[model samples]
Target: MLYVPFAILVAALLFGVPIAFSLTLAGAFGLWITLGDVGQVVEVVGTTVFSSVADYTLSTVPLFILMAFLASQSGVARELFAALSSWTSNIRGGLAVATVGATGMFGALSGASTAAAAVMSQVAVPNMRSHGYADEVAAGAVAVGATTAILIPPSIALVIYGLMTETSLGDLLIAGILPGVLLAVLLAATILIWVRINPTLAPETYPSSWSERVASLRGVWPSATLILLMLSLLYSGIATPTEVGAIGAVSAMALGFALRRLTWQGVMIAVHQTLRASAMIFLIFIAAKIFGYYLSLSQIPQMLVTWVGHLAVNRWFIIVGIIAGYFVLSMFMDELPLMVITLPLTFPIIVSLGFDPVWFGVLTMMMIAMGLVFPPVGMVAFVVSASGGVALSKVYKGTLFLILSIFAATALLMVFPEIALYLPALVRGREF
Candidate 1:
């Protein structure tokens, strides 16, 4: 009976049905079959709707979505890129490294990967080209940098993970901090290495005036201040996730208006974007709750955990296998649906191993980030290619070495779980 719904889900996904509808229908069928009662399905629907609304933590989802959309209207990406480039232009491969930093900075506000990739591709690639950067190096850096957008705070993907796995929203948000910073630094190092290997890949930078660098910083402080404000409030337990999200949203809108970057039309566009994104996430949430209920009733999570526990291999091998599975699945599917499908199964096995759920959340997010930019299904690579007017081949070729940065960060997190957990622990300890 469990296999029936699972099969239907795969088929629906293959046939191009939206994930929410597929999950809902498949879950409804599974429930109807299991108890020989359709009434239970009705009951599940009613309860799911009520429970979803009543869950205050989940309210953070749309508020953050609104904040991201509103933040995008502020036109911060170009300012961020300019500031980073001006500050770093004196070093070899500095512009390339700056692109990585800028993407992370903008992503801290917008929380949208494709938007980040596109904006940076358009803004940074031409500047790199004129600066004599190899097309491969320039395009690859922007594309790879864009992939990290979701790993930063205020990330939609992290929020989705929190919702699905029932992890504390604040813990998940704070946990991503160190790993995100680590990945950014690794990206900078990767750029330096590539430039050193072939000096022709990037041109030398002229010295930047200190005045120009200081002036450029003006573009970033508003967005940066909002991020710090939210994190501080959440970390200190002065506000709940919902309250922080609302605060972030209002701050972003105010910032946009103050900068004159957001006009009436921009406001409308942000609202429109918020509605679409929020609706999609909401639909998926409802479907997942029902689908999760089916999985619980079927005992699949426990059964799979018990089976994996009996394997003769070392537990870490199973863990490696699980991460590897995410890598492969991520190549073929978008992160959200892929997570919705696999987390229920793998999440249990992770808990069974006595691993911290917050650490696993960060691990899963990193894998998903790699999947977003890795060949041949790297979604951000495609966006960068299209926006930069470069061939997909060149984009991937340039991005190849940087992919190792993500892998290295993941390995470090595995060896030192504190990379993902320290902030969460301190914050939770202080708050709780």
Candidate 2:
């Protein structure tokens, strides 16, 4: 039955069917084969689709999606980048470094890599190019930096993973903060090192006047306040992740209104974009639930757990192998679909190896972050390249170092589980 569903899924994908449809078709086929009753298929599909979307935890998806759209459309990202660049522009490769810092902040608000890439590319890439930075360096900076968005607080990916695995969303959200900052700081350090080695890549500029710097900071206060408000609300337990996202969306709109940038056209466009993204994600969730149901019936997760339990190697090695598999799979697929499809299988293995599910969720997120800069199918890479009008090859060259930095970060998290666990524990208590 598993083989039949897997084959059908593969064929559907090969035939260019959308992943959501492919999953649904595969699940329906499995049900037909297993039950030999066509009538039951409708009932199963209805139940799965309804239950998946009806989940209270799933509410975070649309809220975050709407917040991202509002931020993008309200021009908050541009203002934030401008302020960061003014402060950091004096140092060698400073603007590029600032781009990473700015993107990390925006990542906290948006929590979606593609949104971070798209917004930062439009705001920072041209500014860096104007500052005489290399095209590869500028483009690569935005592409790789944007991946941090997913590892930052209020992350939609972490929220989804927590919901699927029955882990605390708050734990997953808080766990991401330190690692996200580490990745951004490391990337900035890497850029500084590279610029020092090859001065020709990024020419240094004189520092701006004190007045100029002070005035520039004034322009970005809205963004800063928004960040503080959202993070404080989440950390203080004043609001859930979804509520924080809602607050962010409303705050962005208010900021835009105060800045006179929230035109009617922009509002309509934001709404349209938010609806489209939300619909797509909801569909994927429904399809994955259906497929997961079929896999459960086949007892595949249990079987794989038993097999892993019988292995002679150290459990950590098996865990590493699973993480490596996710990395490889991410190269050919989007994170959402790949996560939805693979977690059902791989998650059980991780549990059997006696790893903390929250820690593994953070680990999984970092692996997906690496995928954002990986070649061919890396969504963030494509977004930054297209938006910045740079060649993909150049972006790839520039991101290579950043990607390695992310891998190093992943290794640190894997080796020192406390890094991911400590914040969650500190904020949520030991019971988490």
Candidate 3:
């Protein structure tokens, strides 16, 4: 059954089928072959599809996606970049540094790497170009900065990981905060270092007047308020992560309306985008559930776990092996699809080794973060380059520094797990 499904999925993907369709077709084929009855396959497919998407926890996806779309459409992205640039414009490379900082904040609200890249590229790239900053430097900053979305709180990847792993969403969300912030700081520092060494790459801009700087804060307050509301609700246990997402959507729409920026067309577009994205995600999720069920029935997870446990190698070596596998897989796959396919295989192994699943989720997300800026297939890089009308090579060059920064941060987290664990522990009163 497993072999059949894998073959079908691969064949369909190779033929350029959409991922969701390929997954569903593959699962249907697997069920048909295993049951030896077409009727039974139909029944299993129908039942699994219904049960998989009937999850209440999944409601957060569309709501958060909608909120992000609305915020991006309402001119909030430009406001955020402007505010950060005003504060960080004076020093050499400060504009690039501020782009990373702004991207981090934008990532918190949006949680979509492409959206972050598009937003920042539109706002920051032009300004950097006008300032005589190198095209590659500006494009690269936007590309790498956009990837911050993957590790930040409200991340769609984290939410999906929590749902799939059956880990606490709040715990995973909280776990992301520290690592995400640390990565941002490190990336900013990297930009500063590079600018100091090669000042020609990034020209200095005059700092805005204090009054201008202070006034720019008004445009950014909506995003800040939204973040505060989200964090407070989740931290205080006042709402589940799903509820927080729904509240965020409603709040964002309200803000757009109050700002007189929420046109009927914008609302329609947001709803349409949300629906399309939600449908695609749910379909993949349902298909993955059937695939996972088939794998369990075959005892693949247990067999792999038993095999790993039987090995006499050091546990840290095994952990490193698993992380390395994820890093490689991420280069070829989008984070969501990769997680959906591989988490079942890896989760049992990690748990069998006495590792915390929540911590591992954070680590896994960081690995995905690195993949988002990697060359050729990096989705964020593609988005940034296309948005800025810059070459992919330029984007890759700029991301080199940010990638090193992410690796440094990844090493810190790996050496001291507490960076990812501490906040969740303080909030939840137990290690997850």
Candidate 4:
């Protein structure tokens, strides 16, 4: 029965099994029940293992992940934060605002939100605290800022969304650009408002000289050049996502060496990290694929879609319900597993409702981003807490306002779907 596999999944997760194993075992159980043949289930697993991760487009995962680690090793986050901070130093809550800017810039290079949050925690939290910024405000800014990576270009989250849903990968990546920028701006504005409302949260500081600010800009060129190069190739349609990822990875390495910031040891570490992360992601992919096969055989998604169509309520109510469900589940689960597990069911339902897949994909990704900073099991919050030595309570407290910003951004996107879909349309128009 459909209920049994899901019950098994919940039980496995409760018992502290690894997510990959949990998904594989639960899915295998469902297959054995439906097919009534262990050999058939074994056959499904064997084929899904090879077919799931073998796509050429999936190469984008490891390459972008490699670029992220290499960029981290090369000190991209440190320099970008320093440069942005110089410009914002005189403003109230300047360092925190700079942290948001630096996070957005780092998002251009890396697709991993946790990595962005961790790096910024190390680079920005100390300066903010030293400058009299509240621990909650500093940690909150870093955590929420990191969420931008999932909406920005070269986002691994979007790529995985595209691959799973059979949407246009390039469109999905491009679709995130405007929404990402909007979220970053809203976050910055929210910081300013919070500081204005409670001046004690951020004390004013002495301004930097023009010369000092100008000099600081020099620190940003390496990242600027890399961002520019990657965007040009991607927006120009000059290369595939895989090729762009490869170019970005190699260029990041070159910039690291050219600056003498990256050593042989650093390169080794990057490679090792990339391998581990990639393996984890692909394993999820394989498991989710098998789970998907089981779902198709069960026809659960098809049944749900038909059942929903027969309802008398309006569709937006259904949309809200689905989003509410995602928010709840995301609080308890990681992003990738959540996406892979639910998309197989949700994607078809949205399509049946006649909504655009790309739009829904962006919406789903933004929700997942919010989860990254949410309370309890929020991965980004934990990263900021551990890496910055901020109290976990303070980190959660800090994210409170920024989480509101995420909700606001999601509302705007819901009202005006164009916010997430405009650029992707250009891609369809051959303007990419």
Among the numbered candidates, top lDDT falls to 4
Pairs in clash, predicted candidate 2:
none
lDDT of 1 by residue, 129-218 (tens): 999888898888898787677778777788888888888888888888889999999989989998998898987786689999999989
Q: Assess candidate 2 and give its lDDT.
A: 0.85
lDDT of 4 by residue, 1-432 (tens): 776999998899899998889899999999998899999999999999999988999999999999999999988899999899989889898888899999999988889788888889999999898888999999999999999998898899899999998888888888888999999999999999999999998986758899999999888999999988888787778988889999999999999999999998999999999999999999999999988888999999999999999999999999999998888888778789899889998989999998889899889978888888887788889999999999999999989777888999999999999998888677668331
In model 3, which range of ten residues has the least summed lDDT? Answer: 26-35
List the pairs of residues colliding in candidate 4. none
Q: Candidate 2 lDDT, tens digit per residue, 1-432?
A: 568899999889889999999999998888877767888988999888788998777888787777777777777787778788888888998898889988988888788888889889988889888888998889888988998888887788898898778888877888888888888988898888888999988985757877878888876787778878877887788888778877888888888788887887897898899899989989988999988888887788999999888989999889889888888877777778888889999888887777899899989988888887888678788888898888888888888866877978898888788888888888876753
lDDT of 3 by residue, 1-432 (tens): 458788888888789887778877877777666677888878877898889888899888888898898887787878888898889888888888888888888888898787898889988999899998998789878877877788887899999998898998998988888998898888888888888888899866678899999999998899899988988888888899999999999998899999887887998898998899889899889988887766776677899999998998999999998888888878767888889888988998998899988899999988887888887688788888888888888888888766888899999999999998898898878753
The residue pairs in collision within model 1 are: none
* Model 1 bad stretches (over 4 Å): 430-432
Find the candidate with the highest TM-score and give its number: 4
Q: Which ten residues in a row have the lowest lDDT in candidate 4?
A: 423-432
For model 2, the superposed segments whose C-alpha errors exceed 4 Å read none
Q: Is candidate 1 or candidate 2 better by lDDT?
A: 1
- Report residue 67 deviation for candidate 2 (angstroms): 1.3
